[model samples]
Target: MNRRRFLQSSAALSLLTAADFAPWQAISAFARELDDFVRGPAVKDHPLRQVSKHVWMIFSPDGFPTPENQGMMCNITFVDTAEGLVVVDSGTSVQIGEMAIRQIRKAFNKPVIAIINTHYHGDHWLGNHAYVDAYGDSLPLYAHPGTIQAIQGVQGNMWRTLMEQWTNQATIGTRVVPPRLPLKNGDELKFGDVTLRMHHFGVVHTPYDLCVEVLEDGVTLIGDVAMDHRIANMDDGSYLGTFKAYDSLEKMGSRIWLPGHGEPGAGVLKWNRRLFEGIYQPCEQAIKDGLALEETKARVLKDPRVSSQARDTKGFETNIGKYVSLAYLEAEAAGF
Candidate 1:
């Protein structure tokens, strides 16, 4: 049996032979210790790698959570500004955030001054707990108003539960700590040597998805608006809105587009654009032709961009059909 269960069994046996009140007091103290042990061990530190002049990242190659990965499914980016280190997206859990903090201390040895939650997704922002713990409640945590609201409401606990389920309780002790400051599009914050500009295109990835441009580094931290090789979950996103966001992002003239899920590169937005078009355009055409959902799925699968990316893209085979259906439904609604 596990340590907690064994302790419980021993406690029960001692209770059967209780001749004194001291044993009961000891069991109560032991119960408090058991409560402290609910969460699994802290995640091992992942090495931090520099991505730009000011940005360093703890890159998690995996895109989905598993017991083995312990919910480290998103990239934790640290921008080293003269003021201090600014965390782009904290990570997936308190353990993951603590692990990232360990790496940050080893590499940069700077305190985290601020944290920006790109969207309301737990994988991107649930690690806020660790930063707040290390720094204090006074540390600035920024996000779009909608993101802050969602996390403050049901989305906060909902994601905490989901991550726990997905990671087989590996993330058991994480608590929801939503962003406090709300940032809108075109807002700029100066952090000593670094200047960050926030961009929000309505309902692209989510209604309040915030993309932060590190102006000095010529890189934009594109939250889930696009990804490198994996298709984004579009349950709250739009094909048309994503395209519009891409148009606006390209005009900003940032050279490197870093994503929350994959490696940073110039082609991050382009790669997602091509893949999204491959998934959505054919469905749009199918809707115009009065084609059924299955037929649209076939057309999307046969598209050159989709077929070529199928082998390399994570969740493409399993998620493409659902994406095609969403695209077809969107196209039909747009036609109305």
Candidate 2:
């Protein structure tokens, strides 16, 4: 059989196996079986904008996934190296990656030789499917060890499920493709003429957010550790740790900081830092004053730093309270 036939057979077999498991699984499998000939909906192609000499980005204006956006929420970056193209954060799904591939081919002639997943966030890496399809499966997928482990564990499937729900099944049919290679802090990878230096400082966005610096370009792709206008999800993050990261990252002196969300610019880190401080500082003070979480939330809202950016920040009204609450709890724990 040809490669295409083999892949089709494997897919059909997987669906058949799932059909034997449970009532829900059987129903899902039956639905997939009915649509076995159809592929997942392809995401509309977003134009790639060049950030620096070697880096280009497919910017997603939406910060959160919705049925309309179809999980195109995170920024997908590409580094054009002499060796081949290096993908930073593949994207949210197979369809998204497929769209990115079209965009990349339109702008650059180089093939994608490697993929770097910034973290285990589904939005950041689930699009590994399209890359693996376009390039061979041997394409090296790199991530911090903790990120690799998390994606290979429950976080991988959990994110796939979450994206499907968030996009109203638009991201359905995306497989969990975890990064196979583990990178550590201070590791330097030379992709032909361009050099990539990895930076991981304890816990910021997640326990293993990896920032890739394009040394020659003087650009660092800081993952979800910092977002432009959107407040980062602090469910597995630390305000103190994030502050420390900002301090260290600033010292790195990269002229341009590219975030996983939002446009890349010189002011990216400072913008996120000021907004985070607005949310976290008040919570820290509230803990000192023995104030309640509700009071802390009010204080955070009243802070000029946060309030000024409220209208511009996506999901600020809906997410700030939760971010403030997490910061409050972290502050309370730190006081002990």
Candidate 2 Cα misplacement greater than 4 A, ranges: 1-38
Evaluated at residue 203, the lDDT of candidate 1 is: 86
TM-score of each: 0.90, 0.90
lDDT of 2 by residue, 219-334 (tens): 99998988898878989999999999999999999999999988888999899999999988898899989899988888999999988989999888888878888899989999
Query: Could you list the CA RMSD of all candidates, in the order they appear?
Result: 3.9, 5.5
* Candidate 2: count of backbone clashes, pairs at least 3 residues apart or interchain: 0
* Per-residue error (Å), model 1, residue 129: 0.8
**Model 2 — TM-score against the truth?**
0.90
Error of 2 at 235 (Å): 0.5
Span of ten consecutive residues with least summed lDDT in model 2: 30-39
Clashing pairs in model 2, backbone N/Cα/C closer than 3 A:
none
